[model samples]
Target: MTTAALGPNRTSRLAARRGRQRRWHRNRQPIGLLYVAPFAVLFAMFLVWPTIYGFYLSFTDRNLAGASAPSFVGLANYLEAFADQVVWRSMGNTVWFTVLTTIPLVILPLVVALLVNLNLRGQWFWRLAIFMPFLLASTVVSQIFTWLFNPDLGLINAALGSIGMTGPAWLQDPKTAMTAVVIATVWWTIGFNFLLFLAALQNIPAQIYEAASVDGASAWRQVFLITLPLIRRTVLLVVALQVLASIKVFDQIYQMTGGGPANSTRAILMYVYDTGFSNYRLGYASAISYIFFVIVVVLSLVQVRFFSRKADR
Candidate 1:
């Protein structure tokens, strides 16, 4: 064939190959989409739909019974939420709970995990014992703690009495109720974070510690310089998880405190429940929920920013 003719033939073959590849790509697209369709459907139905619906509901004046007609009052519910003293009280309570719980949950678990990782007797038993609380249902744990915090027959007060200490009426008194609830929450949930830290600790290579030892570094110095810096990612993860979880804490406060003793322990979730169900103000409840969501998002962003800065350093 002539050189020009040969070039045209080669170009034609190349075009045909490209056309085949394009057809194959088009054919694969549907199968890939089909594989993901279930998750897409679920997300739309559960997460996306509810989120959109909740936002819509927040703008209207809907009642719990659905008997009254809803009137669209743009931002009125939100305004009411801000003006309402109970909402602020609930927000304050949630912030207090988050601060009270997050610190202990993040720090105590790390300390316990460190202790467990060291040479100890019956290490696996200690680990299992430490983690046993996480296996129980939240409601179940709350109920058990509820009885334990009971004023009259609770073993906790009895133990304190034996030790010459007058135990306060834990669940009944507002001052003690919130504190007791926080302590129970910390105990019940700390195990999971502890295990996470423990796993991160184990994944650190022993060679690093040996190298530190050869450099004549003390144990505490090794921890501060080597172990802590290396596990910074996991520590950040634990802190983020605890902070978020603590902010949204509901079940323990619900079951144990009932946001009771003059609503001193009423969290944002409890306020939402009271507004929607108890007072039959669905719109107000929805508005408060969105506000709470915003607060959570802002706090999460702060955590992320701090985490990023630490990582950069």
Candidate 2:
């Protein structure tokens, strides 16, 4: 009788333990979910909602004028943009600027980073000086350069004349306006890329270079065979950044040229601004913006694949 009574009591105790364990698990689940809730809400509110709304706006004939409802126009905006000569011309100029700027922006910075990495005096000073321009506001840099590029009384013109070379009308001439913008962008932003390269260069172990020297490798040979190969990831990162930045160049162009001199320096961003604000064709501008966004996305994916393959090798 005693043994049978104790068996029932022991079984009841085991059941109670399992019940408590289940309740504990249930309580912890909600806490975990609570931690993720804030980020999820913000991501949905800011990123997801705006993206969907923008896509919807692209199909409608919306404007900022009156409080009238948008008329659904389907693919009309895209068709109009495709047929427009100015749209195509602006796209060409944007691509040209991106290509021209990306090269110098990637190359010059890497070279400067390498030189700065050498055993030289005042390393901090050199780094600070190079990076100072990046801290300036885009508008400030653009305004300063605008004054410098003035044909009549600009410092740049004066310097060129002193060297016995005639300077072109940088902002007035359609031919050289885009080039001037590219030059300004490079000087203003190359510092960021240089700092990135410098950091990557420093991360590389000094012992590796010392070993290369011990094996009688010349500086150029060591750079090609070891240094370049080691910092392949940083190079790709710098290139990708420059490409994206060059594509979405708006502030500098807006402040410097205002897409003037016969639209020679006009970028796709300027085109979007003109369509949306100046012309009040919000739907058409949204379509162009989406198209450009898609292009950038695709290009970024391609570059990632290319760089990933190289890193793997």
Candidate 3:
């Protein structure tokens, strides 16, 4: 074609392209926002806005039963939390519970996963049985354990009597209440860690064990020198997860013991709930929850670091 004809054709093409680009530029953000709008609204409504408002509420006298409007109280609630003996006791109970439960929750699951990973005769049954409790509702588990731990007419005490031993009041006694809650939490939640460990175990190459066997490494030796080292990261990941979950314990404990006999099993979360709803002190409850939130953030950072270091290794 002649230069004049080609020039007109190119001009028309460039104009069309520019028009399309302009249309796209006008539509991109809106289209993207439209796709994201549902999740954004839900997240803000349930998580972000509540977190922001709860922080604001922490600095006010926002009593649920108060007839007057909430007034700003500055740091008074926080100051009171620091001085409150029940706060410290509940916090201590939470820490103690975390300590007790984290050990078995992490260790027992790995051990069970290891045993199950041994290719037992009834693999499906073992796996399902080990994991079934985790699927139970917290309320249901609480009820089951409550009955099991009953001082009278319960199988646990009945078995104890058969063994010529008397069982303590698991849910009623201050001494054993937290212990009972810990046992329930372990039975209810250990399956998750077991699954994690089992997955990591399965991912391990069989040749590594074969190589270890060829080298005359005993079964226990292979576990110690090969399997464990390879799954070290998984173990740490489980520990971190268990720690965080144990710290937030409330539901089963609440349903089983009601934070009794003398509030021995009361977690920090229970304290926060009782403060907010039961006592109608919303401001104090918010402050305690925010404090707990900060502690959790710090703990999460530490756990991430612990998990990251081994993974990087």
Candidate 4:
């Protein structure tokens, strides 16, 4: 007993030694960095360096063609972008598209997920049907929709004719071009949001609904009070993600409309591409892109503040 009091037992010493070893292992900073160095180098080489260089390019006249040497132009490109009516118009179109798509995309997914979560008939089939389009490549979806919206022989117009109604020249008219793009985007992207909402719904306990039912709560009431509150975070997440995605939309619109019909469907990103590659003014494109980037950063900050307040409440 005296010996035990004077020194820790051998087993206790061994455990204490193991604890120290674990702490030492965890604190091996250089070794941990060595393990991560390859990915770090690749990320820096591909993403970080390019982002930094592009920002630098925004201040200079960097021609894509080798016709002229790059010269520092300071804020000249930014000033030009600020005064350009087309840039403002494209920004407006982007916001309009975001507004048109965000509401339906968020609401439809939630509704579909709620119904599917009730164990409806053909559960797996419903899930697959809802999510299959998201698995298709953007280029394929855009091409299919392009053909579907064709003025002459498209199925949509034929279906309209069967109802004795005239279909507008969907893609050929400037008035309808943006609307067509919005429709295509919603159909292509809604599946991802559906899965997010479905996962959230599944996480909700079944007992809550049962208790509400026993207490005389109707289906609509349960949805309004219980389900919505439970899935509020998921809804916000979907909205934020959808807004960002819509803002950055390029691929489908590029392939389908080509920002045509008088550039009515031109997005800011499309403008950037046109400026950089088509016009061969890489510096001006970089400047316009940076302006759009600043706007995005502001929106993100606002969302963060809003979500933080919501969480606190």
What is the Å distance of residue 212 in model 2 from its true position? 1.6
Where does the lowest 10-residue lDDT sum fall in candidate 1? 26-35
Stretches of candidate 3 off by over 4 Å are 1-30
Number of the top-ranking candidate, with TM-score as the measure: 4
lDDT of 3 by residue, 1-313 (tens): 5998999899999999999989898876667788889999999999999899999999999999999999999999999999999998999999999999999988899999989988889999998988999999999999999999999988889999999999998888998888888888988998899999999999999989889899999989988999999999888878887888889988998899888889798899999999999999999999999999998899888878877776886
Off by over 4 Å in 1: 1-27
Q: Give the TM-score of candidate 1.
A: 0.89
Q: What does candidate 2 score in Cα RMSD to the true structure?
A: 10.2
* TM-score per candidate, chains pooled: 0.89, 0.88, 0.89, 0.91
Given candidate 3, what's the lDDT at residue 304? 82
Error of 3 at 69 (Å): 0.6
Span of ten consecutive residues with least summed lDDT in model 4: 2-11
| Cα-lDDT of candidate 1 | 0.90
State, as a TM-score between 0 and 1, how close model 3 is to the true structure.
Answer: 0.89
Which of candidates 1 and 3 is the stronger one according to lDDT? 3
Candidate 4: residue 59 lDDT (0-100): 96
Give the least accurate 10-residue stretch of model 3, judged by summed lDDT: 304-313
